[model samples]
Target: MSQSDELAAQDAGDSGDGPIEELAELQVKEEARLEKLFAEQREERGLDDETTLHTFFKLFDMWIQLYRLNKCMEVLPEVVPICRSRGGDFHVKGVQALAFTLWKKSQFNDAVKLFHEIEDLIGCSAALCENMGHTYSSMGNFDKASEYFKRALQCLDKEEELGKKTGDRAGILLGLGLIEDRLGRFEQALASVRESQALFRQRANGKPSSLVAKAGMSIAKILLKLALQEPDDDKRQEMEDEAIIREEENVALFEVTCGEDSPLTASALRGLGEAQKRRGRVPEAIASFARSYQIEAQKDAFDLLGIMEVHNHLFGAHMDLVKLGNPLNRASFRNYLPTVDLALDRVRSMKQDANAGAYYKVAGEFAAFAEEYQRASKLLSEAVCLFKTEDDSKVEGLISHCEELKDFCDAQLSAVRGSATANVSESKS
Candidate 1:
């Protein structure tokens, strides 16, 4: 057989073996040769406690190949001290890798510490600064995130002056736009995203890329926000129409770039559904959300935030579908109630999380749809308490609104009971 065919045959034989099993088998087969190589390398380098990290590095490599992120994290704490003791490219690569691994684990503090190490080592490059910015953004520190992102752009600009490739520079713009959006600097966010979109378009080799699609979604989302804030009816209509157009374009780009069943396409579908919901296309919105939810449900691994958001959207779509006064949809609406219940249970368990306010608000809304008015009131009340405890001034207005909603539900329950009591009294008479 040719080399390719031989490799293919070997792959075919191992295809049925699980990832851990395959790795174990390979390690067992390579033990003797690996031992000899390791001994020679240690002898050459004069092995020490710090040098032991070089051996631990192999575990991280395996974990990366297996998508075993938690395992990578477990190995990282052991690797870091040794790397700090033995300074070289090993230290540099180890610090960067540890920062990224910490970021993956959502341990933003440790990630930022390693980011500082990277900065102290060789100063910040575009990638290093962008990573710091990303970690800050994930921790909900928009101001710090924006600062680093801008610094990243500056670094990339310097690289361009030196005739370097300046690859992925547009990503800095994307990050800046996201942070700006979080800070409610809509106009600036729009400009950055538009610029990033143009750059991605310029770089695309015919096919639409994920970056382009994401930039389009950001534009659409910003437009939607602007439309909601617009005072003039005619101007608001124009903005809404533009948002709808961009949302459609986003779906098209995602379908082309990620195919229909991929997570990217599902997210695009969800965005389109949100736009359709705003346009009062209840049936279309319901269909889009159902499709997105189905696609996401088939995947075993999904971020907590994404899964919660999908469940929220699905609940809202079902509620909207029922609002159309369609009997068929009324029954189907109940089918989605269980999903929201499960999602709410998960969110309740994460009550101490930073996102607790949003999660509680979504779950409360879902409960309202299920006619569990008391449950809705309780969840909204907890959400208010969490927002207060978390010192989130940004969402004070939202907390007030949900509090009012909880009170309204309480009033509704009282009214229903009062009417039922009157009917029973009349029947007794």
Candidate 2:
């Protein structure tokens, strides 16, 4: 037999083992060798001599890959003390990684401590400050987040004057935009996002980068916010139309650069759903949100998926059982009520969190459903209270609606008691 035929016959005899498996085994061996090299370098540098810092870092990275964020956090403290003791360029990098890992694991206090430590060691890099701001923002301390984001911008500006590349500056601008958006500074957010978009477009030589995807997503978010604020019917329609166009473009860019499975793609899909909802395309909006929710769920992005569902309902994709049409339509609507109720229940649970306002707004959405209105009103009133404390003008309408509902409920209770008294008097007569 020829050599190829002989190997094929032997493979067939061995139950069809193939070259792909051999390649995978070779890759694993190569990775092991590379990891060994990293460990040797760490030991020679005397950083965690007994246990390699590189190995710990690699293990933490692997934990993140496996979606074991809590485990990653548990390993981080072990590496951090060694990095702090042995001060070097890699030490700063280690601090940054640890801070980010803590932030991802929702250990905000630890993240802040590490960020402060990094700032002291590195003398304030924009990247460190921006990440600290992100950690604060995730913790719902928007004011503190905005302060750090501004500091990051200042650092980036100084670096730019010293002839640094534009990449860091662009990143700072994007960070500022996100912080501003969260704080409801829509105009400032737009300006920051646009600046970042311009910078990314200038940097793109031909192919798309992750930066481009980020910029597109930021601009889309700004546009969506603007659309929401527009009060004039024609103006709002125009804004929604523009937002839809931007969303489609962003989705295309995200798919091309990061593929459909990435968080950016999921965000773009959610934005598209929002725009479609604004345009009164309920079915299309629901479909887009459903896909976005599926992708986010697969990535364990539960909070983000919940936010998307809230918007889906807020945009008037009927979640209640009430129908304005025939019996079949009523049945179809009824079929969706269970899902709607589940979403509302999840939102209600989230409202018990420190940041209750976000969930309350979502719960308030089901207020039109008579069966759910009382709960919705209570949630809406709580949201209004939070927003009122923040000096948000948008809460006025919600507060008024909540008061009206409360009054209506009181009146109904009084009428029921009066009727009971009348029945008792008639029975005595």
Candidate 3:
């Protein structure tokens, strides 16, 4: 309705492109007007009162719900100082918002510093400590992250005694589970994840749809990881069976709460596929993978990285069937070739990791099976480079296997070279 805003809109309408700048300008004006209104209201109502403090907290929470990170970031810097100036219950949330913004921005060190400073000023809170835990975890400071997460759990327990919400306790457990899993502490990860799953189930209060499903998925994932590390066949099968049961629960819950087409259902299906594969139900595993891939393709097919993962799973399923001498249509995986190539190209552009090496090796092996020896040799060479970055004893077997496979591929090419040379020599003579 403002003159400048109307003019900007009119100019944007004249062009075919949408009015990004005009929309942003209008947003800024709206924010300014709201700020002025809130200031006026604060003047009449008094900022020191509980009601006004409640209003700011709600405002910040609304910003979070809307995912207005830039706006939230802008307001947080000013809001924290104002809260510190007056000092109230709002400071707790102000610190949370500021620290969360810093964490989201990937300014991990600054976020940690700000959280500690806020703790010194207004004392530590569960949410603030949780933010620091997440921040340090993301920054790869696992020890510090573990320390803060445990502290968060303790504070949350004390807060629960005051009749506050304990939903955050489940979140802390989930975080601990993830960290433990990454650290290769499978038992600890299972304990934490299982505890979180139990907590979520207990708190289900008629509408635990997402909460229960999430916790179940976490447990299922941990079980799968444990199964991967287990050398005993029977124990691994048992682990996989447990994981399948968990994933089936998640899938059923998602089917009721969401739909069959939901991404949660797709995720559950993918996990189910892996579990079934490990449990020696290859046919069921292949079916589950195909279903998962179909759902993912329909919903988010253009998500390159995600598609690559799905393709990898699908390819593995097919390869597993092939190994068992089952009649599987190998042509079904031909479509994945281009996607694998794309993933290889993209991964090559980034810093090498074990995951990158695995992808490369699998793609190379797939190519070799298809008798695309030149492509296989090229991809396998890239895989060799990435694998060299890993020195963990666990990966030595994988590295050796890769070298052996690469040599096989080279020999096949060499035989082709010899045959071609013989033909050329005969023709020249």
Candidate 4:
């Protein structure tokens, strides 16, 4: 059978197994098949041949479709010599693919450099601006991201005027909204996101597609934030209630569309947890956070920073329970220590000094509250070092505060050890 037919047959014969897992496995198999096919073609035609380059492009696209971005990174360098010699269009396509793959792989700096190269070659298009916007947003450069998103919107508008629809308007609006939200323009963010959500809904024929779910989630989160800023108690409560309902709907929608085990579902759950926590529903919040943690932690390419954030939430929720004098939650501290340790280890491995510093500081605060003074001091010291290395204006104050806290924790640890040693000596005497 042909490859397409074989894939169709496989999909048709899919049993009652996990749909997301099954789909992922299918993609992996397809990627492997393509790789093998490409190898055979390259061996026959050699790298510089037209047929081999065609196969190379096909393989690169396949890798992107399968989210096997690392594979794209591995092969791009090998094909660069041939692709550059072919033509401007060919080289542009290859470079664009590499940049996009790098962004997907979280190598933002390298991705930006390649993106600039693409712009230097062919000038800016809506798609190029959109990709750059996304990459900048990922790097936390909100102002630059906003500029790119606006540029993309302008390009889209020009295209629309020319009667050439690209169907990227909704996504661009959503991206702008996200950047505005980060920049604290909440009202603008809300309006943009709501408009984007409406567009997505219309595109989906009022159905729940992934785009609609994402836009809905963004709207819900903005509403939750607005609720926090509301002056009137009644209006705040109403907004909070609406946000919670929207979150719950999004969670259900994600479970149906992306599977319960999907990262989208986990993110929806985490948002729901945040909403619940805001409403002082500690136990419910804990359950939601725990479920989110479970799903995210199981993924092979899990977002370590996201997982750490979830762990922090879980720790906070558990600590809240203990603060309320819940005996059941007291032992939960012991259960959480290992998770905190694991998260900190992963953060250190990430080599993002600022992010690692923030995580360490948070972990240290939790450890200090748990009376694990020694661990707290160590964590705080690491944070101090990291913060000191950064060039932010606030870093010096943060470093001093962390150092002060670390001193307190060290003193507490020493006192505790001294008390224990004295008790042992008395018993021996």
By TM-score, who's the top model here? 4
| Candidate 4, run of 10 with poorest lDDT | 1-10
What's the true lDDT of residue 302 in model 1?
37
Residue runs of model 1 more than 4 Å from their true location after superposition: 1-87, 104-106, 165-167, 231-238, 248-267, 291-309, 334-429
Question: For candidate 2, lDDT tens digit of each residue in 75-140?
Answer: 566666777677785577567666655555456788788778877876776666676666677677
Whose lDDT is greatest here? 4
Candidate 4, residues 296-316: lDDT per residue as tens digits? 665434466787778778878
What does the lDDT read for residue 272 in candidate 2? 82
Residue lDDT tens for model 1, 1-429: 000000110111211222223233344344445446555765676444445455545444444322345656665676676677778867876786676555655578877897898789988777677777777887888788888888887888888889874325666777788787888989898898889878867866565555577777888788788778889988887876777787778777656544565555677777778888887876787777877766654432335667666777777766665577655444554556665565555556654654776777766866776677888898888778777876657777878889889998899899989999999999999
lDDT of each: 0.66, 0.58, 0.66, 0.71
The lDDT, on a scale of 0 to 1, for candidate 2 is 0.58
lDDT of 3 by residue, 252-277 (tens): 87666545765556778887888888
Candidate 1: C-alpha lDDT: 0.66
